[model samples]
Target: MIELKSAGELDAMRLAGKVVATALRAVAAGAAVGTSLRELDEIAAGVLADAGARSSFLHYQPGGAPSPFPAVLCTSVNDAVVHGIPNGYRLRDGDLLSIDFGAEVDGWHGDAATSFVVGTADQRDLDLIAVTERALAAGIDAARPGNRLGDIGHAIGGIGRAAGYGLLADHGGHGIGRAMHEPPSVPNEGVAGKGLRLRPGMVLAIEPMLVAGGGDSYRPAEDGWTLCTFDGSRAAHAEHTVAVTSDGPRVLTTE
Candidate 1:
């Protein structure tokens, strides 16, 4: 069932959201050529620990998963789309890195992700990241009380499709609160004024994943956790947790 958070609960959630934003910022600043993905994960873990928070992804076993997630953060590089487990691989110049992280504070959860270029980035790479960020911003702007969930998706899809980027329909956004995932799944592509109606007290994680090539994706190696593009084309993902309020959509996960 979908739970509407009370004002007090929303405040608690903001705390968690702040921690997520801080963690992502730290990871992004540390991400550079010659930096290891594992080191990035460690940086996030330390931030969460110092804040007295817990990792929402650690040991998180989704349905049909063989085992729980092992890492505190997901470090997807280049062609890797999402859920890229941290490894010993060192980043290289011109590599695009996507970092996804979540935090649980006082039992409330917040999830966010950002994509960045490691070193000297190509124009195509920079453009892809900029478009993805713009798409996410559009989606968040569409999220307000009384707006349909489809409005959010449509906003994101419009930008992505117009850019000739493939929209991955498989994985999308979701309602997030006490749990990492909640009711009312938010797809990246949909018709405005359709699906669940947005209302005050509803919080959601709006994410847009765009691929430079066709939107086709596949599981990486035997890890079962990492997802990558089938054609090896670079991908970008951007996300933010927002809350629908009487005034408008308030972004909770901000520095």
Candidate 2:
């Protein structure tokens, strides 16, 4: 069932979102060419500790995952699309990195992800990231009352298609509240005006994962996590936790 958030619950979710935003900022700041992915995860852990928030990723064993997730953040680099486990792999110049983080505060949960280059950036990588972020923005903008859930997906997928990028077909966003994953899966591509009708107090984590190879196929890494593009093409992911309000879409996961 889709459990809509009350006004007070939404306020609590905003607090969780702030913590998630702060951690992402800190992780991004500490991400340098020489830094290891594990080090970046530690930076996010510190942020959650200081904020008195709990990580929504650590030890999380969602269905289909091989084991409990072992880190506080998901660090996908280059071809790796999502669920990239933090490891000893060090960042290098021109490397594209995508970081996903989530936090829980006062029983509310918020999740978000961002992608960027480590040091010097390639034009192709920059373009991929730009398009992915644009797709995320479009998805958020469509998250308003009187609009259907598929409208948001159509908005997101349209941008990727027009840019000649391929969106991951299987993975997308979901409802977020007391749990990180809730009802009403939100796809990255859909027919506009189809699916669930948007309603006030509905909160969703709208994420867009785009691949530069113009294909949607992916493979799991040896670690039982870290999905990588099947065509060896780099990918970008962007996300925000947005709430549908009487006024419009209010993004909770922002700085």
Candidate 3:
């Protein structure tokens, strides 16, 4: 069921959202060439700990999964798309990195993701990241009360299609509140007038994962968590948790 958050609940959710934003910012600032993905995870874990926040991803076991997630953040690098576990691998120059994290504060949850270039990024990689960020913004802008969920997807899809990037349809965003994932799945592509209608007090996470090659497919790595592009092309992902209000769409996970 779709739960509409009360004003008080939204305020508490904002606290969790702020923590997520802060953690992502700190993680991004600490990321650089030669930095290990495991180290990045540690940074995020520390931030959440310092804030006295609970991680929504830690030890989270979704259906069909062999085990629970073990990290505080999902670190996807280059060909790896999403759910990339942090490990001992050190980043190299020109590598693209995607960091996804979620936190719970005052019993509410927020999730966000960001993609960044390690060092001396390639122009094509930079462009891909820019496009993904722009697509996310477009989707967020479309998340006002009375707007259909398809409007959000259409806004994101238009940018991806115009740039000729491959949209990863398998994974997108979801409703976030007391739980990290909830009702009303938000896809990256859809018809403009279909799906659930947006309403005040509804919060959603809007994420767009784009690939530089064919929109073909991906596979799980031997690690059983990381998802990599089947064609070995670079990928980028961006996300934000937003709330539909009487006024407009408010982005809760902003610094």
For this target, which candidate reaches the highest lDDT against the unseen true structure? 2
Q: Per-candidate RMSD vs. true structure? A: 1.0, 0.6, 0.9
Q: What is the per-residue lDDT of model 3 for residues 122-189, given as tens digits with 9 covering 90 to 100? A: 99999999999999999999998888999999999999989998887588899999889998899898
lDDT of each: 0.91, 0.95, 0.93
The RMSD (Cα, Å) of candidate 2 is 0.6
**Tens digits of lDDT, candidate 2, 27-47:** 999999999999999999999
Stretches of candidate 3 off by over 4 Å are none
Candidate 2 global CA lDDT score: 0.95
Candidate 3 weakest ten by summed lDDT = 214-223
TM-score for each candidate, following the candidate numbering = 0.98, 0.99, 0.98
lDDT of 1: 0.91
Rank candidates by TM-score, best first: 2, 3, 1
Positional deviation of residue 15's Cα in model 1 after best superposition, in angstroms = 0.5
